[model samples]
Target chain A: MTVLDEIETCIPALRRYAHALLRDREGAEDLVQDCLERAVARRTLWRGDGPVRAWLFRILLNRFRDVRRSAEGRAQLVPLDATVEPARSGGQEAHLDLREVHAAMGRLPFDQRAALLLVALEGMSLAEAARVLDIPEGTLTSRLARARETLRRMTGRAPAQDLVERK
Target chain B: MSDNLPIDDEALIRLRHGEPADREKLADLLAADPSLRERLAEWDRQDAALATLYNPLADEPVPARHQDLLAAAARAPGWRFRWPERIAAAMAFLAIGTVAGWFAALHQMPGPAEADLATEAMRAYATYSVEVLHPVEVPASAASHLESWLSKRVGRPITPPDLSGNGFRLLGGRVLPDSQGTAALMLYENDLGQRLALYVAPAPAGVETAFRFAQSGAAQGFWWVDNRLGCALVGDLPHDALRKLSLSAYDQIDQT
Candidate 1:
């Protein structure tokens, strides 16, 4: 496939991933568009050493981090209630609800959430996800384990017998 | 059957994703342990929940804007020359020569090498001031953060002078990549929407601190080297007005 075609195919996945990260549909789309423009403009920089998909994700993530840092400067402008996901309450539930899982995902640290999404939502392999995140595979694995453990606890899916281990 | 398993989290994660190299060993363990099976199922459920939440976004038709962008990019020639960026760069180089020559003629002194820094500022001002969308990487509203960030990158404590008294409010600032380490450009705008920029970079040690003036096209600049910092104050305003702002800006930035 041409580089543009490869990039085109990744757009939907990019949109999904951006939406998951930003939790704002319009903002996510804008971010994806910006990322696509950048990737195209700098297409010459894309060495055939890695999958174009990973490079695109890396660009999107870098853009996301820039937007986030700028957002941090104007923190008061963001409504606290709107951004904070409500913690899922109550004891162990037998099934995980999508909304609950999403809110729990939001509560995950950015690193952990990013790792989890690459592995789970995008179905990228551990090594591929690590490349996208620019982290060691062992670090990504640990983040995933921590993310799942946190998700289970927040969604009240932690096995009853496992409660004693919880501090 | 206990929560403890011989496999590490990495092996278990691989198994849950069905990429385990030792499938036979894991399968035997799963057969002996319902808990391990349950754990794998839980991972499956979590992935399913995430997929349910986000997959529809992918399934939805691609937005027109995205499709349009891809199409436009595809239509572009492989070896395209971006005229706007090229024009800006050419104008900058021209400004450098014009300013350097002016310093040589008007001052009766050999053109200071720092005049190039002045025109670099002019170039930055010309390029970014016309930018409607992203004139500055960090907006002026984040003044404190912008200051500290630029200061760290430029390797000099930079305080963007308050120019409100001179009918200009700070618009924002950005760190510029320079051949000599880095420079910081702080943009300011007047009520008429005219912009002025202050470019600051670390000067070479023992450099003369002579103040200088240079102009190119509609843009004029007043620049100087003081206390190991090279600074240029650039704008399209007339000579006297731009000179006035530059002196005060020099004073304010010099104190830092």
Candidate 2:
């Protein structure tokens, strides 16, 4: 398939990752739109040697950083932690509290959250996530481990088996 | 506090995320410490929770604005020349006032506010022209329906211009939100799938202007006001070609 078609297949995953990173629906969509525009505009610069999905992810991460830096410079940055609306009503809410999970995600550093979301939410391989973040695989691993620990501690959740028993 | 363990939390996390690991060591670690399995399962549950929270976003249809950006960019030249070329194009485009004086003596140049008609038209063209599943709210097959619906909504007697002579068949049209009340978008496509859009909206009566050209990247537009209606014809065709098509569309709309 053409590069555009491949990019098309990656949009849903990109949106999911963007939403996970920003924790804001409109911002995530706007970020995704900017990402797609850049991806298409620079379509020629992307060599087909690597997976286009990774390249797209790389573009998105870079764009997010640029936006964050500018927002920080302006002192108008809405803390990612502050912007997460509570989980909407009507979910199963059986075992783990998704709201707690989301809040904990917000509290994590951007790097850790990005690594965790790329691996767990987008299901990218560890190496792929590392490439997207332009970090070493070891760094990616530590970030994921730290993110998981922070999340567990912040959410104050027991082991999975314990949650099941409580349910 | 399993930092000293050869199979530490990082290793387990890596394994959970599908990184290749020393399986014999992991299995032995799991066997020696049953709690390791619990930790792995907890991480999996967190992942499950995340999926529950955000996966629905993936299933949501991508908004039309994004689709328009993709369509416009895809149609743009493969190698973008960046701002310099764009600025030069803008200068060249603005210089058309001299050409305008000769082309239509009676009409005035569109001021910045009035130029929104062209911008809106280009935006609508970028959006609807690339739609694969639903290009238009009403299809050309229902010609009369499209005409009457758009006419009534736009509060003008509107009809989709016949451009078959220009080798473009009427594809269909849709009503779009306009800053000045309602606007109508009629689409036409050639056999090669190249599409064009005509945007029509209400303008003050007793005012008329000749065609004014505007270019944004690959999309070119020629907008004019006549018969109390503001109209813009937008497409990705060559400048002269689109200009010709716009004049033809103008004559057809004028006659109707």
Candidate 3:
């Protein structure tokens, strides 16, 4: 199969990832479709050296960033539906509490969220993600650290502890 | 307690790496401090919620029309501004026409096969196009389910074409019969109103090695034989444009 054909198979996964990241179904699919078209048109120039999936993802993430940057002043959050129940039962009432978390996630600077999601959701290794994001590994680590801290504070979680215990 | 706390940046970096040993160390540190434990629990809750929010959206069905649109767009012709290439495309059509005439002269007694096949394909195309309420026996949105269902009916394993790159998404496929016998007609469309149909059947005896193109009124018909399968791509587009679409369809079907 041609590289174009191989890239076609990755669309569903790309769409899913984009949708999750954008939280808008139509916008996410459009981004993935556009990315696929760009990839296909550039297939001849593609070096076939790196993982195609990662390369496609990088294109997608970059497109998302561009859109986010251009629409900075116009960005609006979709209010979470209060009626939907949490997936799991917990005394903390994760469903109600999660709206705040989602908002906080949106509020995070794009680089931090991209780094955090690349690791936590997409399951990319730190090095792989750093390569995809075109940043130094140290930079990725710092972004992830800041992201977690921001999330912790937003969720009303206490600060990190200093106690140590031997394993 | 304060002295025992591992630095926040270090612990977070470790957690992102999925280092369980670091988590254990952090957990130990948090356990000694009530406020830190509470914070860690909150972070865990946030992760859980984020996962929940995104996971289900991935499984939701992409609208059928979007799949159709992508499929159609992929088949659209590439931009060409050069006169020589346009002339070459014209010559290709003339060559195909000449070949068709030669075949017609050789056969003398024309059978209804070509006409019948084109009509069947075009009819199936039109039927599916207007089908506002159930165009395909199996919708492409449930691709896995459609694969199994169409395969069972056709008595052969069939994989749907991946047209995402062409801007055409597989909306799924269905089995339809023509005057000739059982045929599989896969429906695909694009954001534009264009739609392409793939008509497949076992090749008739002795007629297993010919590539034929027929323009039926406004629609273009492409038929070819590869081993035992008779494949045709019928669509309402220019002949050269149709060939490119047929080639893509052939690539997709042949791979499957």
Q: Which candidate should be chosen as best, given lDDT against the real structure?
A: 2
The interface RMSD for candidate 3 is 8.8
Per-residue alpha-carbon lDDT of candidate 3 for residues B1-256, written as tens digits (9 for 90 to 100): 6555455764556553645675677667666777656655565666677777676765666555445544554564754113224334434654566655544554433246644666677777777766767767777756667777766765556666544334354556788875555677777776575777777765455554334676766777787655445677777877776765665565445444
In angstroms, how far off is B229's CA in candidate 2? 47
What lDDT would each prediction earn against the true structure?
Answer: 0.76, 0.77, 0.63
Ranking by lDDT: 2, 1, 3
- Segments in model 2 whose C-alpha atoms lie over 4 Å from true places: A76-94, A158-167, B1-6, B18-33, B77-256
Kindly indicate the candidate among 1 and 2 with the higher TM-score: 1
DockQ of structure 1: 0.30
Best candidate (score: TM-score): 1
Interface RMSD of 1: 9.2
Error of 3 at B169 (Å): 34
Q: How close is chain B to the truth by TM-score, in each candidate? A: 0.57, 0.60, 0.53
RMSD (CA, Å), candidate 2 to true, equals 18.8
Pairs in steric clash, model 1? none
TM-score of chain A of each: 0.84, 0.82, 0.72
Q: What is the TM-score of chain B in candidate 1?
A: 0.57
What ordering of candidates by DockQ runs from best to worst?
Answer: 1, 2, 3
Could you tell me the lDDT of residue A87 within candidate 1?
44
Judging by lDDT, tell me the better candidate of 1 and 2.
Answer: 2
